[model samples]
Target: MQNSIFKTAEVTDYIVQWLKDYALTSGVKGYVIGISGGIDSAVTSVLCAQTGLPVLCVEMPIHQAPSHVSRAKEHIAFLQNKFSNVQAVEADLTPAFETFKNAVPPSDNENLLNLTLANTRARLRMTALYYFAGLHQSLVAGTGNKIEDFGVGFFTKYGDGGVDVSPIADLMKSEVKAIGKYLQIPTSIIQAKPTDGLFGDDRSDEDQLGANYDELEEAMLAFENGIQATNLTGRKREVFDIFCRLNRINQHKINPIPVCKIPKELK
Candidate 1:
């Protein structure tokens, strides 16, 4: 689907230029990105490479699926061949993740434990990204897109969401795919099911959300335009409810962190 507001080529160029400007102004050597072998990361990494600055693409996998690992390696190789400044590293974090799991106290609820561990994977990856960023004087460039970052808040707070800069957070998922195609991101990545890869399984993001990106995007646009839920029916209504429910419950992830303030006199 074509975005009515911006052409793909133009948007791609704009983002690349924006990244260059942000990195130069911040005096950072480049960007450190965690490559998940998904469209978002592939596109974001490509854009970062276009900046002509050192771009470290780190694949920090913790019990990752083989397909995700292969795709990630393929993307890194593609980037290295195309951009001289792009570098790749693999930090197998399975041992670290196992150690963390052992250190943490067990919970009775298996479901909650699974979910918490998934988020833990993301946090571990985030820590790895920052470690490389600090060591190389680079900023952590986030790969979140519009639908995940804002619409449904699908990203892990302070995990995948922790970053010095968000290069593609404003673009919708469809737009990101378009940009990815324009950048010639490996077809394997562009066509692969979008997965967080936190669960070490084959489940796609749609499987977890109970709705696909297209459906969620439609609901998001409708909600933004003040379309009432009552007007929607059938699957539309169901998807809208899913969008709203997730949007509402995940506000803590979407909004700025709350800060407690004391009165001036008390201070």
Candidate 2:
């Protein structure tokens, strides 16, 4: 297979310029992003900072792991030192999550309950971002990559997927990492395992998706380009099957929400 690698500096410059143009034309004051200490968020925040516009990096922890918070702080500090426009804030959502979760109807299905609560965590973070965005007239920057956003629909609708602009949404996971390295984001964050941070546990993106990002990205690239999953063999076939199943099941997320169209005659 041909190399899937991207030109680090070129991609970084493109995204940086994209952010600059977006803020200029959109008339937003600045950028607001949830810095989850994951590679995608770290890279997105750095790109926003590079635009020389005021960027607020909010660490909205909801029963967050110590390591995740630590990495987030580290990245925040790193960017603040490098860019005058970059600032960090903490919005602890643990109390909100607790209040919200307590009100949910009790369920015998632990899995269903956990999933609902996890999605709640994401929505709360989204709410916090918008709260500040409205206050500062800024836009919420999204961090989902192509694989998660378009392939598996790994993001919670109107939660992590909620944003004003997604600078890296077109890029794959591998491409995001490449840009992360080029931007000199903290090595610890770039190398850290990816997570949604909504589960309140240390479960990773791979664990939830049932496939590693590299495998999923490759399979998805093929699938989107009209390559059939049935054409693969051996381990490739396994990965393709996982990708296909996820794409089929989560297709709703990437598709337009169904709306009833009334007939003109009836009207």
Candidate 3:
């Protein structure tokens, strides 16, 4: 996590270095980021831009997307105006999302409508990202952060989380915000409470988690810093329990499915 003195040269060094590390790991020429007019996307776009690679900031808006799309465009324009090699692309997802919803059979899992809808948006965004990546020979710069990953298994599996490289995946939500501020990302984006924005306006990542980022941050610190929780509140303990069950249940989502392979010579 980033310590204080957000706009210091050291902070910039850390951000740039993280981007370089991901580029080395993925061997990607550039980055394609799903920019949602939110802090995570803004910070990621800025960091990737700082790496001196071309950046594709894409907006994949489903039917439920808000005026935020315009906000997204403004942010993308800011990136292009201020930085080099930043291109903006908008991909409409209304038809694809509706078609998938229409195709789902009536009897297939009645209880997971919100889940299905959210996953649908995420997967569609992924489809667009991968296509853009193929065109540019770049890696998808994923927007998920450590706080979201730790709490309640919130992100859609292999959907938004599907990416060749993730710059902010290791940082907590506050850490992400601190970096965003240091990077001079738009304050509206920085202050935006994150939502998957998959479902209608009623949806939010924190709401789904049944716990907010503060609790999530505490739990993450407890695990990472080996800190004692002697003064932990009852609500926090409840949130911790939720995190525990979620970490266990969503383990499958985090890991790639296994397949048994016979030796080629045996054939």
TM-score of every candidate: 0.98, 0.96, 0.86
Top of the candidates by TM-score: 1
Q: After superposition, how far is residue 214 of candidate 2 from its true place, in Å?
A: 0.5
Scored by lDDT, the top model is 1
lDDT of 2: 0.89
Candidate 1 lDDT over residue span 1-267, tens digit each: 446776888888898899999999998899999999999999999999998999999999898899999999999999999999998888999999999999989999999999999999999989999999999999999999999999999999989999988988998899999899899999999999999999999999999999999899999999999999999999999999999999999999999999998899997
- Pick out the ten consecutive residues of candidate 2 with the lowest summed lDDT: 1-10
- In model 2, the runs with Cα more than 4 Å from the true position are 1-5
Enumerate residue pairs that collide in model 2.
Answer: none
lDDT preference between candidates 1 and 3, better one: 1
lDDT of each: 0.93, 0.89, 0.78
Model 3 lDDT per residue over 171-208, tens place: 77878888778778877777777777777563666777
lDDT of 1 at 84: 95
User: Runs in model 1 with CA error above 4 Å?
Assistant: none
Runs of candidate 3 exceeding 4 Å displacement: 1-11, 21-27, 108-110, 224-231, 256-267
In model 3, the worst 10-residue window by lDDT is: 1-10
